[model samples]
Target: MLTKKLNRFNTLRNQILTVFLFVMTVVLLFVGVTTFHVVSTLLKNNAEEQIEQTVTQANGRLEALYKQLDGLTNQITTNMYVQQMLLKEVNGDYLGFRERQNLQQLVNSFQTYSDGIQSFELYTSNYKRVFPLDEIDLVNRLGIHWVKQAEEAKGKMVWIGRDPKSPHFFVVLRQIRLMDRWFSPGGYLLVRINPEYFQFTDFITSKTKKQGYMLVADRDLTPIFSNFVGDSKEILHAQQRTVQQNGEEYIVVKQTSPLTGWVLMIVTPVSALTDGVAILKNTILFSGAIGFLIFFIFSLFLSTMVTQPILKLTKAMQRGKDGELRPSPPISSTVEINELNDTYNALVENINHLIQVVYEKELVRSRAELKALQAQINPHFLFNTLDALYWSLVEKEEEELAQVVLNMSELFRYTVSNSKQDEWVTLYEEIEHIRRYMEIMKLRWGDRLLWNIVIPASCFDIRIPKLLIQPLVENAVLHGIGNKTDLGIVWVTVEDCHESSDIVIKVADDGYGMDEQTKEKVNELLNNKEVSSAKGSGMALVNVNKRLQLYYGEERKLVIHSELGQGTVVLLKIPKSGEE
Candidate 1:
């Protein structure tokens, strides 16, 4: 559960917020850590300087004590009465009562000028000791070793340490020289000085003591006394600096006391120096978290501000695809989003305008062409029928004229009726209308316009557009039969193409057909080879051809086969599908 809550997703808002928070966190951490480090470093340096001062002051006090002790030793060695007593003791002569009393008075006088001196006594050349003894080292030979080192110094002081029997202390040995002979030693003086005698640890205050530790080492880098957690030799050997012992880091600074020859080293732990920065770390982390939260919220707002407009534009595009080609409503957003909306609205409006202008224009044009063709057929047929009736009346044939009038009335009613606006009629009805049309033309041309029609029973109920066939029959009667002088025959053949699921109709004439050039021109116009530019003989066939293609689709082609002396057949292939 905690892991899931800590996980960040790849949503736009999250991405934006993450980037902003990352940059902000980096900058804040950089600044905060840098400030903490710099302050911690400054504190360390200041503490180091203070520690060095304390060690220097401690060394000065020790140097003063050394001078005082040296003066006291000079006084005791140079005194005429004290030297006589020491000579009497070294020669094994018994000391007189008055002489011992004078020597004790001299020792009391030396003790009055010195402080923190555990002992101040002289030892004779015969190994007779006068100072305090930590137990006689006759079995260990340590006392003999100190005496031998003191004799080697001749007249100088030798500060010595490493007495296994002693507790945190050292000895100062000086060979007692004779007054008469400068290099001749009468005996040696011993001073066992406690490290706490001068109270050097008191130099470190309570606050600074918590910061680090202090150590005192001998001239050969051997630690005599140390508060550091390491072996005496380990502390002394790490004199240069930067020692890691017990997983704790320390900075070592050393100052050697000239008189005492002790290395006073301040071992300041590095971790202790930066202890004050913990508060700073907590403060920076708290403030950074608050800042990151605020930035994340701001990023979310910004992400929504950018994405909402795009979502709206996407919805508008979806509406356009759904056929709602209308302009979008006003939107309040950035400039780019507003521009995109405006452009999209404009595109939809342009599409709607094109639909209105182009598609409606095409519909109006098709209707006009159909009506014009119908009008042309009606008037031409009426004039020709009237002329044929006039000729019958001139011959005084009442019955034939009356019969022609009735047929023409029925044909006009079929073609011009306003009851059916869609002009749909079954194939049987269309064939009957063609029969009546041919009968009137046969009356007008007599034997020159004989006609025959072949229509199948199965094709009788198939519906087709009205007046789609009459014009072809009329064209064969007037052009092919009227142009010949002998008896002409018009053949109308209709067959159901079962395999192709279509109805094939042919209107042929046995009269003389046109020349090769004329036939080519007529067929070109009928086939619509020149689009809407052809003008001449096959206008009626062209009218039927266009209506066929417009009602049934463009694949319906009006095929024509003609020969100069043989006759012409116009083959119309129409689909068997219903039309209304």
Candidate 2:
């Protein structure tokens, strides 16, 4: 009898121990996952915030550098010796050897005032000259010809090219015109600036110790100065090839000088700016893991105390499954476990209610997604209609009819090709779609519809959104010229608006145009306002307007100008291609 009692006691203890280990493992796992996720998110956000702050500091430093350079250029332009050289009379003729020596003395005096200047040269339209000693023979020996460019530039300041005298310098040529005639031929003032003057290392040396690099690139993405020395040609090429790069996140601040034609680029590496945040993330992860391990060990000890009474109750519940409602065990270690037991029983009673709620929510979400998919069916329907029309014309042995159908089919294909979300199509693709649309219209209306598309070759490769222009053209045919009695003329033109920094597309039609009331209705729709019930169908125009506003902003919306008898002209002011 004693041995049997001992065996039952040991069996009960082993069951309690197993339940304790299982509960502790579950609690520790939940804590670990929750801690890790919360800490990781916080670390990432802090890192990004820190990086933004560093970028702001770097931008400030670069702006200061730009200001300093501008001041330096102004100083050189106003130097007394430079002014004296500008005042000298050349009479459109070559300077004597003695006169060249005097000009060299002036250049040397100006060079003494600024250490950044590597060299200076003077050249006239009639004769090429060098300063600080006549090096015309040497210039001829080296085959350096900058005199032609000075004449081409006339009286304006121009960056001729990379310096032939010294590869490390960039030559700035300021043509000096005579004050009396202004047309009288004058000499050129050539100033060579050392590349090291713009190098960021002189000011950003302290930041480099904290993991930062500053670099300056020209408008062509040619590296003018860099913190590290080597051939940066490949990096410069990569920067020019794409607006952004993979595996490298950088912030580029550009300062363009109208006076100098120089595009100063300030580049800050993201890694240097966010290194502190990376360290913080690693620290948090390490500490959280250590905390989880300690909590796991502590929970194991605590579970041993809590699971004894629960094990007894669990076994009683198992017995109840066989139709015996035995009472639970008496006397637990803590009130929390007793409360947990009560909660679990309540949850079991209402499990069906929770399941019903989850199922209903999921069903509602699925129905919403189905409705969204249903709304996208119109484009597919239109494409199918065009395909059917094409095949029907082909079967009837009508060549012109078949060609028109095919063109319409191609137009719809281009419109529905939305596989790429951020795809930038060439201007040529846009023109091709317009051509297909016009061909279809010509076949439908015969000689009644007249169209002229004038697009320059320079605008062909510019990137625009796919199907951007065709929609307006379609609207013109469907609404503007569809009801016109006499021959209708539609003119489409693409031109560069350099002053506005954009490409202007003008679509003008000499057909029956809208009155003031109808024009106001169209304007309301373009502004995303609801039209009055009396106003007619404007769905296509509204859709086009919304899409343009979505892709670009309100500033890039379509501008309409029209009169009752003067017809209508639609002007689209889209940003130039390759802009950020």
Candidate 3:
């Protein structure tokens, strides 16, 4: 009988607990398996970051030292006194006894530039001079291999790695030009360095000091020096950063210095990276089961209380569903049920009122649409009337008057077409439409009003909201320069802003500009969304601003730049096709 009961699916308690247990077990297993992988990935990333940071820090210091050494070379080479001596030698003139004494003292003074100067020697085609002549020449002293490098570099400094005699020191060689002329090879200046003052290894963070070791290599990747316990050449020349030697895995990270063209690398064992991850991941998965068990017990206890409130709410909803629509009884046991009851009560109270309100809104919307249609009237009727006026003037032999009337007819024809609810027009159509409007304005103002349109023909195919630029042109004519007697120029330019993937249209007029207060007011009016529709050119400005925002977004609003006497420039940007 116990086995039959266990096999049977009967009570909600048994069914719920069994399904919940299966789900929680699957979830816990998934969390445990994935947690180990996630922790491993995180540790690897942190290790790579640590090693890379160490290499960068150490390389940065080394590059700084090299730059300082380069600076010292510049200081001694460009010294005016040095230039005079080099020129004298390049001219094949022998130095007098007094001049040679002066040259030695001048070379002796260079020791003050850096304390790392192990030896300073200058070689000329005519003769040779050394600061401390007792010290053997390390530059040419170790064969002419370094001298050839310096000679090949012309006048630039050539950096050779370490001195084979004393590995702790390095050498720099340069073939000095005659008075800074590259064509004239005057002499060679060689300086041996003791890097104790500049070569710094402590820049690497102390935390990583034990995990890995760093090495600085020249452009050819020859290792200058390293702290590796084993051979450094095997790891340095490996094709891949991850290497295995003596049955152990190691990871390498490298960064090349731009200043010195040297490679900085860090090498560490793979074991050090995954040191604590296994223990931490195991601890997390172990504690997770205990925590979930406690949660399961509490959830079962809470499940018993949930059904009562649900049953009460169900009965209330059942009565409403049967045409007794009314408020549900109040519930305070859970915030969810309490809020559900409050929402249902509010819906019951507001349903009839909402229906009536929607009906009224529809009625108002229909009336508005009807008024808009009536206001549009018919464009053809107006067009016919303007046609009659144009012909009447033509019959009287008034050619210019007839032409002005014809342009006016075309301008109004385009403006009235906008009332037909057309939203998009090719930019070419927009510019052409404004051409007629400006012609009419110009014919009225004569020489006082002049205009120019500069738009790439390529941009003519782009579609924009109808009449976008007309209002700006109209504002420039009627508001900006309409009252000024002096000749005012209105420039309309459209540029394809490739960087931003937008088109910028500028309408600028050099007229008596607005005062600070009025300009502020006009700007506020353009940005104010609550503005009511009004008549005249001002409303036209607002409508254009509103349409730009509606078609694009809030960021597409018109930008106005103006000052007291510099006039005003209105800038508007239209995003490319997909940008909208």
Per-candidate total of colliding backbone pairs:
0, 0, 0
User: Can you write out model 1's per-residue Cα lDDT over 293-388, one digit (the tens) per residue?
Assistant: 887788779878877777677777888789877777777988887898899888888788667645544663566557556765666577577667
Q: Rank the candidates by TM-score, best first.
A: 1, 3, 2
> Residue 172 in model 3: shift from native, Å?
1.4
- Per-candidate TM-scores read 0.51, 0.41, 0.43
Predictions in order: lDDT: 0.72, 0.63, 0.75
Model 2 RMSD in angstroms: 48.0
Arrange candidates, best lDDT first: 3, 1, 2
Local accuracy of candidate 2 as per-residue lDDT tens digits, 1-580: 9999877767544555556556656665676667656765665456445444544555565556555544554454455554445445454344556766875775566667555677766655344564545447423522345555555766555554467657778766665665554555555566777876565554444544444445556555655666633334544444442234456655433444444434444345556545665666676668667866676566556655666767766876786577555455444567876776665566544554444445543453354346445544787787788788878888898878888878877776665454444346888888898999899888878899999999888788888876667777877887788878888888889988767778889888887788999899888877753322232456556655654654565455788888897788888877776333
Alpha-carbon shift of residue 182 in model 1 (angstroms): 5.6
Q: Quantify how close model 3 is to the true structure by its C-alpha RMSD in Å.
A: 39.1
For 1-580, candidate 3 gives per-residue lDDT tens digits of 9888767746455556667777787887788778878888898888888777777777777777788877887777777777778788777676666775777677768778777688767766433653444435434455568777877888788888776666777777777776655557777677788756554456554747447767777888877667767768887787798988888898988888887788877888888788867687768777777867876896576655665676677787788778676777787678987887788788877864555445543453454457556655775787898899999999999998888899988776666553334557788989998888888887889989889999997798888877789988988888889878889999999998877778899999998778888877777778776534467646656767866765676678888888888888988888767225
